[model samples]
Target: MAELLDDLRAETASFEALLRPLGDDDWERPTPAEGWAIRDQVSHLAWFDDAAGRAVTDPDGHRAALAGSGRGDGPGDVAAGGPAGSWVDALVLEARGRTPADLLAWFRTARARSIEVFTTLGARDRVPWYGPDMSGASFVTARLMETWAHGQDVADALGVTRPPTARLRHVASIGFRARPYSFAVRGLPAPAEPVRAELTMPDGAMWTAGPGDAESVVRGPVLDFCLAVTQRIHLSDTALEMAGSPAREWMEIAQAFAGPPGRGRAPVSG
Candidate 1:
């Protein structure tokens, strides 16, 4: 567990490293994610990291903190109060005029605070978070997943390629675990049968989940699966493969990550 938190901190650090080198123009660049600019994406990560730090250091604060502290809510709920498409619209409007350096500093401070709180926690501590109760370890994993997922958007904004990291397997696993909620959010039955997901990790090792010989299969690079769940890498992109009835069903509304089901984004290609 300590190792996982350490890795998460490292991932956050690497993500910040990527953020720091961006040109000023890069911060205002529009991403494929509809209304979010590169700066908004960074702010989103910073907001969640700060909130998670608060969740750990002051668990009994307000309901808003408790409600948005989980892995799923990081990017999803920033505009939860408004109508469809209003959240991102509002956020982008608010983020205007913020320089890339401003966003970078926000992220750096938030991430440092998060690492501090995370490192101090006992593994067994139950942090009040969105969706469900999470151990400190689970919370950290969610943060790592969020870092990688949002990092993809920043990479895309810069038209750069980030080498897929082994940590993405951890991110993909969270998305897989959220499958049931995805179905529920879409008003569908959670599948009774398990779907097999076999991903080739960045290191060329296979990470398999769910039942083999199961009625459904989702195969591809783990990075794609992570992106699919996070709604960063489009399904149409050269990232993942899907097969079987359950796999197809899952893809129709495969928002394995949290926040108000992102129904406002442009159609994810493929």
Candidate 2:
């Protein structure tokens, strides 16, 4: 639990650190997320954290919140956050009246409250996410992926690189497990064979999954695998080696991070 909490803190804090240093001009900089300024991105992050916190404290309250806000059924799109353009518009509108300091304060408060809810959960607790249900630990892992993925967007907007964390290996592993689901979500044929993941941990230990075969092999530092899964780094951009039919297909549709597909910016270059 402590490790999970620390991971959560690190993930959220890194984002805040990036947001806090932005100047007025920087806030208006375009991110990889289409039509979204850096301020819009931060506002979306703050909004979701606040909304999810409400869900934890009062699930019914969130339903009412959504209802009262007239966001019912939420833009009728695959993305849980709403239509891609709607999110950008909503975020931009929300940020219009706020300063960077105000955004940071809201971010901090929402995140702190969200963590408080997590601290209260047991290992076995599960919660509903945008798509499938996830155990509490799984939910945290998903959040880690999103944090890193979006952090990449912010970093790309700023032309700065955010260092990868050892904790992200957990997210990559989750991504590996989620390949079948990814295919299912896309209405593609499920892999006839399982792809192997051989990860070299930061501490020099190793983790292996499935059987290495014609399917695929993901190797090198665990961080590379996580980076690829979160779309922070392209599969072709990293040292990770992938082979086989299913592996290649999985890489194309891989979405280890949470949220709806199609919105998160896929890697443009290897």
Candidate 3:
């Protein structure tokens, strides 16, 4: 738990560093996430961070606050009419008048509070989240995943290339574990056969998941796999080698983060 928290803090710090140098104009730059500016992306993170803290400290209050906003039926509830993305859009719109500094400050405060709560909680304790309850470990990993995924949008909007690091192992793990949910959410049956993930890390070490003898395999750079699973880049645009029917199909519709099905990026032509 301590190690995971350390990694979470590192991921948060890296994201903050990315946002720290941007000028006011840069905050309004449109990101690849349809209709969301850089500010909107950061604001979304800030809102969720605070919610995460509340979930740890006061789950009932969190649900009440979410219901009060008419954002959804309750905390983490996306059953309301319209696309799940609409809930996020509404939240971002509510913060339209906030300055970039205000957004940053909110994020920092919320992040600190979340970290404190997680550090104090028992590892086995479950905390309510937007979609489902999560253990202390899963909760931290979820936050890390969000921070990295959103940071990718901010980096793309600025035309900045942030090299992938070993921290991506956590992101890839989430993507791999989300395989069944990815299919279930789309009303498709998850394949009975398990898919193996074999990725080469940035430091040249290999990360492998699943049984070695599994018939399905996804092999490539960990970075590309992370981007594909996060829906930041089309699977076809990546160099990942898919070895079985299940692996290929999973890559085609992979999504690590929760919410409704995402409109993944278009393929890049060679």
List TM-scores for all candidates, in order: 0.84, 0.82, 0.92
- RMSD each, Å: 3.7, 3.7, 3.1
Query: Which candidate, 1 or 3, has the higher lDDT?
Result: 3
lDDT of 1 by residue, 195-243 (tens): 8899999888999999777868898888777777776644676456778
The order of the candidates by lDDT, greatest first, is 3, 1, 2
lDDT of candidate 3? 0.82
Higher-TM-score candidate among 2 and 3? Answer: 3
Q: Model 3: runs farther than 4 Å from truth?
A: 63-85
Return the top candidate by lDDT.
3
What alpha-carbon RMSD in Å does predicted model 3 have with respect to the real structure?
Answer: 3.1
Taken over the whole model, the C-alpha lDDT of each candidate is 0.72, 0.67, 0.82
Global fold similarity of model 1 (TM-score)? 0.84
Deviation from truth (RMSD, Å), model 1: 3.7
- Local error of candidate 3 at 215, Å? 0.9
lDDT of 1 at 211: 77
- The predicted structure with the larger TM-score, 1 or 2, is 1
